[model samples]
Target: MNRSSFRSVLYLAAILPFFFSDCKKSSSGPASGSGGNGYYTRFKMNGSSVEYDSQPFAGITLLKSDSLYTCVMVAYKDVNAGLKNAVTIIIYSANPIAANVGYNDPLKSRRSNGIMVPQTTIFWYDSTGTGYLTAGEFADNTGNTGIAGVIANAKLTITEMTSASVKGTFSGTVYRSDLARSAAITDGEFYLKRSQ
Candidate 1:
């Protein structure tokens, strides 16, 4: 990730939730979308699920249900210790139903009313020529609560296959409840590259 890109991630870690949530309407105005009578109306997504070399990446997913639009993102690093390979999907719409969509929702974890899981996975790279990182499973919860964790199998898979010119580096600060943990993604990226 370039310095600008890292900055962008840090920015998203702060305000992207608006883009991910029902905070704004899909059209016609700024933050004017409505989640009318329904069981949908979710909150936010993390990655864009873009396809480059026949693969998905660390991205935010946009999911719209009976009445809402939600976003989901999955990313993690820390490969060697096998301790930070976790995925957190957060969902929160301005609607009551959307309130159910979140990672690690104590009330909704085992219930079916909160998360909408389809078929998807995402991969992200710490930097160009640094190796690739992947996340699995899906975790959901509301922002008010703690984000849950997905049981993922992560690894660093980059070895003399691509040109460094096209690959990139990653940087960004995280917004954790505890500011001390603000370097979440950075820690992940560094670990991914070092392990391989």
Candidate 2:
């Protein structure tokens, strides 16, 4: 495997255990809009809307292993006072992802950027207190407590992007491996500076 493939595998290895483990929901603070920083991402977690911006959003990072591999990362933390809950989104692609194009399968894994799957898997790190990462799927969580595929029908839409910055909107259903529960995440948008 190449460097990108190696990194991807490493990440998968690190988070696999969390998929089978049980998840303890952490308390979250008030969701706020952009704090003067033109970036904010909001989504409904089990029907409740949560927002994160530059102030509590922490930072965003972009990484590339080669021409065929790219990763976009966003982090959020410290919302409520003394609250340890945090969230992260890692978007990985094989080809050079451009704006306006809908990348499907936001929950399935591909061997490489050129290779396409029915779904694209996005890494989700829920570091509320007991930090855990999972290759969650994009699927609806209505009455089910455990997810079959983790996530389904995951789609990411990029509204703006550049070497120095990336802006986009993403919406999907997320599934948890620890349990059969899922969350309907919609109207999720973000604008972030590219970090080296």
Among these predictions, the greatest TM-score belongs to: 2
True-structure Cα RMSD, model 2: 9.3
Q: Write the per-residue lDDT of candidate 2 for residues 99-140, one digit (tens) a residue.
A: 786765533335434443333344333543332333333232
Each prediction's Cα lDDT score?
Answer: 0.25, 0.46
| Candidate 2 residue-pair clash tally | 22
Clash count (model 1, backbone only): 30
Cα error, residue 92 of model 1, in Å, equals 8.0
> Any runs in candidate 2 off by more than 4 Å, and if so which?
1-35, 54-67, 79-84, 106-119, 123-127, 130-151
Q: Residue 37, candidate 2: how far off, in angstroms?
A: 2.1
User: Model 2 lDDT vs. the true structure?
Assistant: 0.46
Candidate 1 lowest-lDDT run of ten = 187-196
